[model samples]
Target: MRFGPRLLMALGAAASLLAACDSAPITGRSQMMLVSESEERQMGLQAYQQVLSKEALSHDAQVTALVDKIGRRIAAAAERPPGELWRAPRFRWEFKTVDNKEPNAFCLPGGKVVVYTGILPITRTEAGLAVVVGHEVAHALARHGAERMSDQMVAQVGATAAGVALAATVGGSNRRYVPMMMAALGAGATVGYLLPMSRAQESEADRIGLVLMALAGYDPREAIGVWERMRAANTGKHTAEWLSTHPADSTRLADIRHWLPEAMRYYRPRD
Candidate 1:
């Protein structure tokens, strides 16, 4: 039997989706990616600029110098001749130390990295700081954000398809309930798929970040110390928000410990 136009379209979409799956650079882990690197980079740049517009940048030259120094080194180390795991050789890397009290830092797509002043105490020396920057850059290098967006896109597409299928089964009177059913399905997808994938991404970043720092001439073992300090700093605060979005400190520390040996193979001290 010949396929209908709709059936043909669906088959083509499925084939395209399968073709879109890619492996991450260093870890070679399979990732569902629908967005293009250039598109993700553009979105990252826009978001980076918007964040800079709202957050106050650090005025202390010392803090800025340290962050820039470490960030540049990480970027250099992460940038592996255009075809490596950190594939975006064209990324115009930018680093800024934000004058914030929150112990947080992130690297946006296209190599935009921001460090909060509060994290400096925990990071301590330049090598310790390298640990943090390396992990953040790992997130960008792995294209975790784009993977997430791709996951969401898939969920939305599935949701829409489900809605259409449901509408076909229901009578006119029951058709009105399709939207409610779709909403619930969307919620379930978020809880079941998106959240868990985010946790995985965090863990993957931790793994790759260690290797990047080690390769960049920074001691990879310092990563454990940095996380230990972070755990100490976050002792009494409510962890629900952070834990929901990230791997627990203990879990991360354990993973770092497990991966340290492999990371060490890449380590070479730079003068």
Candidate 2:
């Protein structure tokens, strides 16, 4: 029997999904990863370079050194244990401090980390800095960027399939409705799948970050305080957590508290 377009599209999507199945490090959460690691790293490097070219690097030697120190410690702690299902990528880790006033930080794929100077006040101590660095490092270590790209690929495929199905059903007379249907599908995918996935990844990063900081000899409990300070720092109105990619500050703090005990098991304070 000849396969219809809808049936064929379904099979193709299923096959692609099955072929790209991978797992996140530490958490073992299943991930869709159509992009190869090498490709992802190349993209990350390019993006990192682009950001550096546009932003002013911090000239404060002491603060720069501190970020580098903490980043190195956390990067070391991000290595996977021997025999783990997911092998850690060999990252050419580079940490830079930007002079921007925004309290933001991120670790791109292959361990390119950028920390804005404004976050320093919130991070006050070395341990507190570890909380931020560890979380950012966890994002790279877990390959979240690649997973997100994969999700977008899937979403695009879904939209295309929906378009195909709608075109056939609606015909040219009702063709005007196609764009509306596609828009609705896109929104549904964003709200129903992508947004929730992003929130989950953020929370996962928080949990893994706690463990990394603890393993690096930083007190995991310090994470709670860091987040609390972060919440305090941003006194402006915020978007609802469901619509935002990040968990609400209060939710993030609560999660760190809950994960503290698990992370404490890995804690071995440095003398």
Candidate 3:
């Protein structure tokens, strides 16, 4: 099947866009994912191995046990979707606490979760820990990382197209400036579009995490407390939501409050 160059380009672009279009579970939000689930898991496994090799895994039994216990409970709850089909069974869930001072936690694809030791002080209770862990888990379940990668992939394609167009329009000496102009365009796309997409993903994770924790028999209302404490903990250091890849703590807390009633319906208090 021989096709013209323009026809081939059009077909390739259409296929790429269609291949990247997917919907997130629970939230039902549309996502673009250039990578397959298996591919994402493989990348996650490699990243996990690399991280564990370089970073110090926590030795504190008490913290490690707490994180593991809460993580399992949340993972179990997340598996039982609310009448929605999902990819829980395929996950090879693992939880590890890292000996880091940063108040951060993340769950990679295939359920590889890492909790930084510094976040424990803010997440003082088991339920509080669930809030953080559940949120990280939600990011994985929602495939936000893959979506971000897809967005970057699309941006790279756009940059390449723009560079080609610039080359066709500009003269010899002016061609030298095309690289710098393309760099600026890439940066502008990242700051204007990609950052906002990331922030939206963070908000979606917050909403889904609340439900997961609630279903795990943790109090949904406690999510607010967790964010409130987080807000207080990072008072002077908080970035404006528009400028950062995450919603400001106060904004997150507000959204959590708004979504509490719905999350409450899933609350199944632990016996």
For all candidates in order, the CA lDDT equals 0.75, 0.78, 0.76
User: Which segments of model 2 are wrong by more than 4 Å?
Assistant: 80-86, 159-192
Backbone clash total, candidate 1: 1
Which lDDT tens digits does candidate 3 get at residues 13-112?
6665665578876678888666567756666666677668888999999999989998898889878887664656467889999999999888766688
| Candidates, ranked, lDDT | 2, 3, 1
**Candidate 1 lDDT by residue in tens digits, 163-218:** 23323422133323323322321234455667778788878888888888888899
lDDT of 3 at 123: 86
Per-candidate Cα RMSD to the true structure, in Å, reads 7.6, 7.4, 7.6
**Local error of candidate 3 at residue 162 (angstroms):** 14
What is the per-residue lDDT of model 2 for residues 1-271, given as tens digits with 9 covering 90 to 100? 8998878877765665676688886678999776667766766777678679999999999999999999988888777543563576688999999999899898777789999999999999999999999998988888887777666655665743533432343223332332332232123446667888988998999998888888889999998888898888877867788887789999998888888898998899995
For model 1, where is the 10-residue window of minimal lDDT?
Answer: 177-186
Structural similarity to truth (TM-score) of each candidate: 0.84, 0.85, 0.85
